[model samples]
Target: MEKYIDIIKNSYSGYWRYLKHEIISVNHWDNYFYGLIIISVLVWVLEIIFPWRKDQAIFRKDFWLDTFYMFFNFFLLNLIILIALSNTVAAFFNDILAKIGLSISSFQLFDVDDLPKVLGLFVFFIVSDFVQWNTHRLLHRVPFLWNFHKVHHSVKEMGFAAHLRYHWMEPVVYKSLLYIPIAIIGGFDAQDVAIVHFFNITIGHLNHANLGWDYGILKYVFNNPKMHIWHHAKALPKHVRYGVNFGLTLSIWDYIFKTDYIPHSGKDITLGFEGDENFPKQFLAQELYPLNLNDKKK
Candidate 1:
């Protein structure tokens, strides 16, 4: 027993050393999915007012599986943030700022260590959300991307898993494209980025919750779950039922694009595709099914 224990310890020690030099590390981003879990549940309770479908059911198995993936995506994204492009930009900024002056009396190099990271992440999230909102609308309008995107909108019933119901291509494409610009321009660290992802997942889940309650002015700056819930309504082009809120963080882009969708009006919206029989109910079918959208009007 002692020999085996020592062997295990030795192996772990070597692994730690390898990670220290060859691998980037992640911390301060553990259990990050808690925020998302709570919000999603709340939204579920309120889904009755503007459910994607009148018949949307809450399945126990689907609920847990979606929750599991929320945590999984959080952890996985945090891992990427730590190793790939967290502090490289910060170091670069510090070097440039140092050349100008440490404390030039009028203006210091920076307010604090984490200030730029905070502000930079805020801007990145809002901008990317705007991009996502429009891109989503375009996909629905166009034919090709909508096929895959329909995989997400095809869900007849929504729950916490509804947020994760997106076509797998979305995460790979959006994160890679947006993060690259953010890493280059904002000088974010892996830790800070992870924090943003943690918040984002939480908000996404909260938006998908079936809860009720109007958030008031908070709707202007942030895209609440209630507002986002209407987007996944699976149906399109309702009179006085479209156009109001369109952002996860900031409403600026939605306003600029003239595509901002807000449901501030008191019209009850029927969410989900209008008469969509091909929509899958099983969780595995949601993931395993090809993102291919068939023509000929389902």
Candidate 2:
């Protein structure tokens, strides 16, 4: 029908507009690319100076695969998914809320726009981080979700580039879940979102890097490489929690949830999923591996 055809055309046009205005215009390409380079170089240097596993070479197994994952995630996959899905997802939640005679705006914590810039940034960071922490926990705890998450944990060696290595479905799920709560709290403008992403990128890289600093008391506050390394440990004792330390930027959530675990020395800790030594090493294989639901039984 002409009506359906017009609707399709209008939908495509709206999506393209959203991509241009919300994603492309707001994405500070210069800051993002340059910041990644600087942090990566810095982490690389630190890794060389203080290697976690002396036997491990700089170009260990699956190094290039993780590099591919990093580029694929940053330059292509995640960008397209976020641009395409964000608006529709928000609208879906808004519609559901409206049906119940409620709306996201009614749940607003405060006028986020009215707050000072610094304060607004802080509030956004805390709320977003909390959302991220729980989403991450769910990915590990939920059986079906762990299929996608396993691609990340399959990393044999952790490095700065490892930060961006994730299943493509992850961002879609994470951002969709995050959008409703964020919209309710008075959605963040592009600038606030950009700043939070910058911090996230920086901290994420450091958390997954090979460096060994634990930050003493500060480890209780912000997540560090040492703390996160344990998250990737190949095996934990039966008494020890399997999916411990599920924080993103801050370790406070793990502590509160009693999931935090850090050994006195990480040099002996093994990484990767147990009984997954035969896990596919190629990017394409790993992407498809999750879909083979039969593997989950094993």
Compose the digit string of candidate 2's lDDT tens values, residues 50-132.
Answer: 88777778876677888788877875663455554555556666778999999888887786788888898888899889999
Q: Write the per-residue lDDT of candidate 1 for residues 69-131, one digit (tens) a residue.
A: 555444443343322333343344455668887412224233323456557677666656766
What residue runs in model 2 are displaced by over 4 Å at the alpha carbon? 1-30
lDDT of 2 at 243: 86
The number of the candidate with the highest TM-score is 2
| CA lDDT for candidate 2 | 0.79
What's model 1's TM-score?
0.60
Residue 285 lDDT, candidate 2, scale 0-100: 87
What TM-score should be assigned to candidate 2?
0.86
Model 1 CA deviation exceeding 4 Å by range: 1-29, 33-65, 68-115, 238-246, 262-268, 288-298
Evaluate residue 263 in candidate 1 and report its C-alpha lDDT on the 0 to 100 scale. 43
**What overall lDDT, based on C-alpha atoms, would model 1 receive against the true structure?**
0.53
